[model samples]
Target chain A: MRRDFLLSFAGHVLVVGIAALVGMSRAVRDTRRPIVFSVSVVSGGGTPLPQAGAQGTTLVESKPKSQAKAQSTAQSKTPAKGGGGSGSGTFKRQGLGVGVEGAEALGYSYYLNAMLTRVSDNWLNPYAGQAKVLTATVVFDIERDGTVKDVKVEKKSGDAAYDASCERALLVTDKLPPLPPEFPGPRLKLHLEFEQKP
Target chain B: MVPTTGASPGFLGPFIHAGPFALVDVIALVLMSVASWAIVLRKFRTLGRASRQTRQFLSTWGLRTRLGDYEQVAQRLRHSPLSSLLLAGVKEFNALRAEFGNSQAGPELLQHMIPNITEAMERAASREVAKIEGSLAFLSITTMVAPFMGLLGTVQGVLVTFMTLRGTQIPTLQTIAPGISDALITAVMGLVVAIPAALFYNYFVGKAHELEGDMERFESELTGIMRREIVSSQVEQRKGQ
Candidate 1:
């Protein structure tokens, strides 16, 4: 019995040793997901005029310096008459953007842009690399108290997984800062097009 | 994307979040694994010795004409159940010889000695078999219990996971992944502990039975030899008278 006890103890030690070795050898390397969310603003009106001047305000990657300079210069030449907001109208290359429906014209694009950053920060892609390209458009309304309502998918990326992820991103960001007190409207409508390219 | 954080990371990462009940389950399974392995190793060594010694004892017995010639040999083959049976038979035969001397010996002597000797061998056989089969019950119990214990841990973990989902946030993979990990690790550990125990238990049981059979066959063979020797000696004594 004593010998068996010794042998069992040795066996357990060996097993634990091997397990520790394997675990130690395993590289807990950083896993960088390549899915970047870029939003295209479809202003409240029917036209899909991307805010030409508001290009550089994305989440991660910034647009090239030359292009940003050119857009800033171009904006100065022809300031978007009443296209709204008082921030850089320059576009960023591959980063997060906001699609403020008609808020830009009302000069609330800056507020909506900040809100978009918060939502994107909370966004976690469930279908990170499942497809080459995925795009899901979601529409929702923010009450005067900043609570989101009537979140629905406006366009499906043909993949339920991607659609669900986009919806979840919005649902997870259930509340946002209250609409700017200066804004006239009781609520703000948003049309966010979430796209992932390779 | 954001580098995933907040959850403890590693292969045993889920164990960090294990609740009180889950912790108990893990510790119990580990202990079971250790005890089962100890039993397995000890049984292997014992069964091997028994087999090797029994083979040697049988070979030695085959060469000897009389059971008395094997007394010293049986003394040395302690692990062999056959040796114990032989000793029991030889001891009974000696006792019967002292009771009935050559003048009293007859066909009735064979009848009386054979039954007593067989009974003694049977008693020794049962004792040896019991020794060989000892501690096997623990293996059987471990095989049966470890998996269910793991399952219990898993069910409890998932229950807690769902219960926590009642909070402000809707259930997402992030919110649910840790609890699910805790549940799955227990199940995986359960199978790990059970599979080997089950395999070794079956193997040891079979070995014990084989040893038991060996003792039974040796008993009958030894009894036959002892009977033949007695009959021949009695015939010679009667002829001289």
Candidate 2:
């Protein structure tokens, strides 16, 4: 009986050891390769809009530098007629967006752009050369209070790291400035294609 | 799409939520549970039938004074170990009686018969125990493996959860909760299957021992009665002289 007890105890210890070993190996395997979330913004003015989530006012990444320069020059031309901050920044309507004119729309766009940048700042995608470019389309609701809610990935980047970064970007911006009164609607459902560039 | 290793497979979540390893754990648990349940159910019915038949045989043995009555009832009491033990003893007695050619067995004849009867009784007792014990080893084994199986799953789950964080910038609860929960499910299931098996094993052990004791006591009684009959016959022969 004593021998049996000792043997059983040994077996249990062995099991625990194996489990620990497996867990350690898995952890090592997983964390060894990191994904870096590289973010770029495209503003609607024919410039790449701000990353769906980023922080700050001057987060404009156009396909080309000239487009960004033109948008800046246009901002200088538009009077600071919009509410909040220096509303002097011009609203360049993105082709896909519903066109609305004037300084009020431009003010709303700038603030939204800034919020996406903050989200983008928190994102860290996996490293390059690991795989081809992957894109994750994410959708989220912006409440009237500017708190982000129900952020979901509508399209997955076939990589866990990439998809996770997309979700995290939206989540980090738990709160943003409430939509400007010039913008219609109590809540806004926003969609963006977050890409992991090769 | 990159599978979320951290999502809850939950009770009814789609298989896509769990990694292949976690899915295997769930399958193992389900299969083990089914096997354990089957063992418990079959054991209960076998024991119940054996107990009922044993009681009926005991009552019949008490009502009938003649060995012939036991033979007649033995067929109906086939499930009873006590009935089998009695039949073995009686068959030995009759064989001894026939060998003695109608003369009452002297003490010497009785002495030889006792050994033969003892052997037969022992053999029958073992057979009865074997029948009662069918599939019991499976229960014991299931008890031992249940916890380990659960541990395997839990360990795998924790491993998967940690893996989610590998090469990632930040670890969110969303990425961790699923693995943790999946691990917990296996551990819980293991305990659920194991506890009942252990309880039933102990109960079955007790019943088997009780039946074994009854068979042994009856074997001894058979010897004493045969001895008494022989002694009385010898006295009668001396009185006639």
The top-ranked prediction according to TM-score is 1
Off by over 4 Å in 2: A1-198, B1-10, B14-16, B63-68, B101-107, B233-241
DockQ measured for candidate 2: 0.03
Question: Which candidate has the highest DockQ of all?
Answer: 1
C-alpha root-mean-square deviation, each candidate: 13.8, 17.4
DockQ of each: 0.15, 0.03
| Candidates' chain B TM-scores in the order shown | 0.92, 0.84
Candidate 1 DockQ category? incorrect
C-alpha lDDT (0 to 100) for residue B108 of candidate 1: 61
Q: Against the true structure, whose lDDT is highest? A: 1
User: Candidate 2 chain A: worst 10 consecutive residues by lDDT?
Assistant: A30-39
Q: What is candidate 1's lDDT per residue for A1-198, written digit by digit as tens? A: 778888888888888778767766774442322111224421121212233213223322212323333443233221222232333332332211221212122255555566665555455555443445766778787765778888899889898986887787689888988877655444555656666543
Off by over 4 Å in 1: A28-38, A41-53, A56-198, B1-8, B63-65
